[model samples]
Target: MRLGALGTSSIAWRRTLPTAVRVPEVDLVALAGRSADKAERFAAHFGCAAESGFDALLERPDVEAVYISLPTALHHEWAAKAIRAGKHVLVEKPVGVDAREARELCALAEEHDVVLRENFMFLHHPQHSFVRDLLEKGRLGTLSSFHAAFCIPPLPADDIRYASDMGGGALLDVGVYPLRAAGLLLGPGVRVAGATLRTRATDGLDLSGQALLVSPSGVLAHIAFGFEHAYASTYTLWGDRARVTVDRAFTPPPAYEPVVLLEEQGHQERFTLPAADQLGACLASFAAAVRAGGTDSAREGADLRHDTVAAMELVEAVRREAVRVTVDQ
Candidate 1:
């Protein structure tokens, strides 16, 4: 299966995809970017085929899928096109800028009878399951609360992360991971009780954050994210019996070694998450589903659509309590 990668200012895929995609079964055939000169350099640098235009690459008879790692704003446009072209699509998180777009994209993918996977790579990792098993086994005991935080300082004054037009915000960029962890670990269908957003140097974008989501079971997950704050990154599930803590839950080093502190019986059991590139695993699964005709005969597509819409619902819910900390906005 030949795959085309679209719009990466940084070569994240160059390092990660090789591990996730089976080289024998999948080939990185083409790449597309906004810069022709940069595209040439990226192709030469990554050994990608000369077909650099995104549209042209999608038209390739052998190109079976398109992995879209572009900015949040560009995802819907390209992903929709890929689906219409009768090819499977893997879209990065925050699948759409809003609920309406997400809903439409999901419907379009179904109409075309193509695979549409939101690339929430963490969902595919075995480490998550390993921890989840402990949770189910009552190791963590009765679940209580979840607290997750992800923060990274702005790269530059003009970095895309600070740009509002690109659907940029601490909540959308970093918070989503923790928020997803909260929703997933605590079980889905979250209702936001409150949210507090801190504005950055740039107006309208959250530089720091606080969002509270409550599950039907009354479990609460608190997410703290920032584009200008500490390097703290961790996901913790607290329970009546004990708590399980995982450090570097998201964007972990390529090695995929996650550590956890399991407290029970008056002891702290330190465990290491296995070595793996979950992003690759996610891609592989989507590919497998495509190869098998599908995992749910378009029912999987419906689930993807549901997830996209659900994510947007949370984002909009959080935005209500966003506080302006700067004069710019």
Candidate 2:
């Protein structure tokens, strides 16, 4: 499938565009930007043409799909427009700021008969499969709970994630990763048991937060995320007989061999998983879906759409449960 890029975001220039060009199933044809000069620079880097704007890229006959790496706030609007323009969409994570917006885009995709997928590329990683296999093999006895952490140091003052109008917050940014990790380890039907969101006095945007979630079958997950901390992206699952922990769970470099440790009693076992390019996997998978006429069953597009809404449901619950912190006057 011929694919076009819809933004010049860091993830797009650094990962998505680079990987998309390498995926055999995708022909990196065009890149769109608000400015012609910026688009031209990005397109040149990928050996593709530049379109002055998203509309121009959508109108191009060579572009069959769009990879949207725009801000969180613009995801719904641009994704909807691309779907309506008869192009498949691979949007960045948190397809929308809320469940309702995600549902609307899902419905629009169904109505337009196009595929719409959120690029939570970590889901495509093989390490996750290894973790699942351990669970399925009963290496980890009856599951009890899991804890995940995805924190990173603060960004520059002008970073888009701090922009309230642009749908910026710790809960929507890094928080979604741990939430998705919980669903992957526990189950999809996890519900937020409690949450707390905190913001800096200088800015009201949520800077850090944590959520307690429980799966339908009683599995528990503690998820925490923030933008002002030491870099950490890892999760651990505790079971009756054994516990499994994965380091570099999210944002592992493509060639990095991830470490997984399993502890039973006082004995520990370690495994080094093979290198996997999850971003490339995501591009290939989405390209296959587009080539297959966006069939719902060909890929888990339907379930993914459902999960988008489910994820936001937990996010909303967290927001409602957030306790505002203040200092005595």
Candidate 3:
């Protein structure tokens, strides 16, 4: 797929684009940014053309698809535009600010007959599949509950994550990881039972929060995330006969081996998994869908669309049910 990038965001520079260039199915055609110089720099680094604005990049006939690494608030707007232009879209995670926006984008993609996918690259990692296989094989016995956390130390005050108008907050930025993990591990029909969101008194942006969710089958999920804690990225699944913990649940570097610990009656074991490029895998999947075309493209995108909407709905539910608290800066 000949791909255009719609932003010069840090993630695009550091992770997405670098991995994208290594994917055999992807062709980096152009990059667009508000700043011409920055766009040029990124395009030069990636061996692609640079455009001064998004419209210019979209107008290029060589671009069959676009990867949007824009801010949370801009995802729906640009993604909708790209879909309307008859180009496949791969927007960064959280797909939109809320469920409503996600649904709208999905509908638009269907109407325009283009593929739309949210960039939840972690979902493509094999470690998750390995965990699922273990659960299916009864290694953990009857699943009862799940616990996940993806917290990080505070960022520089000037970071976009701290800007409210840009759809910045802990819930959208980091909390989504655990929430999505809950859905991935526990499956659909998971609903938030309770939630709490802590907002900074000065900016009214959320700083930290937690949620308790329950699956229809009585499986429980306790997820916590924040931007005001030590770096932690892990999740544990508790079952009747045993429990398994993933030490690096999210954001593992391409070359980093992941560790999964299993604890059983009077015994414990550690399993080390091979390093994998999840971003590269994700891009290849998107490229394959684009190449599929017609009915195949739509069929391939259906699950992704469902997952995107479902994840956004969970985020919306958390925000709605959260007991809001104000923390003094």
Candidate 4:
């Protein structure tokens, strides 16, 4: 698959471009940036063509797919444009600022007969499969509750996440990591039980928040996320007879060994999961989906769309229930 990237964003440089190049199924072919100089620099580094803008990149017949890593607010716009141009898209997480937009994107993808995938790269990791296996085998002894947290220290004032118009918020940023993890462990049909959001005083952008979600079967997930705290990305599952804990649940390096801590009856069992390149897996999966096109229908795409809707619904509900916190108050 010949892949192009829209926007020379930081993630494209650090993770997306480098990882996509490593995927055997993907060919990093082009990049588009608002600035010609930045686009050329990124394209040179990745050994691809540099287009002056997204529209120019889209015009290239060789670009079969695109990775949209622009600001959150621009995802829907550019992703829709790419789909309309008959190019498959791998958008950054929170594919849209809300459920309505996500639904629209899914519809556009369907209408255009192209594949659309949100880049929740962590889901592609093998460690998650290992955890799922334990649950399927009843090793966790009937799941009860799950707790996840993905908090990070503050960024500079100029960071895009602090900009309210750009879909910046704690819930949209680090929060989505644990929220998606919650769905993974509990199920997709989770409902928000309650939530609290803290917004920036100056512009009303969320900086921290937490929520409780309950599944139809009564399973619960407690998710906490923030942008002004110590760094941590982890989750723990509690069951009737056992508990499992994993560290670095969101951003583990390709070679980083994953360890799952299992506790039962005062005995601690630790399992070492094999290291894998989750970003590569993500890119490869999307490329394969594009190659298959509409001929081979995929349940994963449908499930992803469903999950995206559920997540955005929960986010809005939490926002409505939130009690704003500001620097003055």
Question: After best superposition, candidate 4 residue 325: deviation in angstroms?
Answer: 2.1
lDDT per residue, candidate 2, 1-329, as tens digits? 88989989988888888888887888999998866788889998899998878898899988888999889999999999999899999999989899889889998998888888989989999999999999999999899899999999988988999888899988898999999888777877889888877786765788888889899889888888998789999999999999999989989999999989999998999999899998888888888788777754434777877787888888888888777663221
lDDT, candidate 1, 124-226, per-residue tens: 7777788899988988777879888888865687777678889777788888787777766776698789888777554566777888888889888888888
Between prediction 3 and prediction 4, which has the larger TM-score?
A: 3
Each candidate structure's TM-score, on Cα atoms with residue i matched to residue i, is 0.91, 0.96, 0.98, 0.97
lDDT of 3 by residue, 1-329 (tens): 89999999999999999988888999899999878899999999999999879998899999999999999999989998898888899999889899999999988888887888888888999999999999999999999999999999999989999999999999999999998898899998899999999999998899999999999889999999999999999999999999999988888888999988999999999999999988899999888887777232354477767877898999999998999899996
Give the top-scoring candidate (lDDT).
Answer: 3
In candidate 4, position 46 carries an lDDT of: 94
The models' CA-based lDDT, in order, is 0.76, 0.88, 0.91, 0.87
lDDT tens per residue, model 4, 142-225? 888999999999988788888889988889988888888877878767888888888777778888888888888888888999
With candidate 4 superimposed using the best TM-score fit, by how many Å does residue 34's alpha carbon deviate from the native?
Answer: 2.0
Evaluated at residue 158, the lDDT of candidate 3 is 93
Worst 10 residues of 3 by lDDT: 294-303
Ranking by TM-score: 3, 4, 2, 1
TM-score of 1: 0.91
Candidate 1 ranges beyond 4 A from true positions: 11-23, 294-301, 327-329
Q: What is the alpha-carbon lDDT of model 3 when measured against the actual structure?
A: 0.91
Q: Looking at model 4, report the run of 10 residues with the lowest lDDT sum.
A: 293-302
Worst 10-residue lDDT window for candidate 1 reads 11-20
Q: Report the error of model 4 at residue 103, Å.
A: 0.4
- Report the Cα lDDT for residue 255, model 3: 96
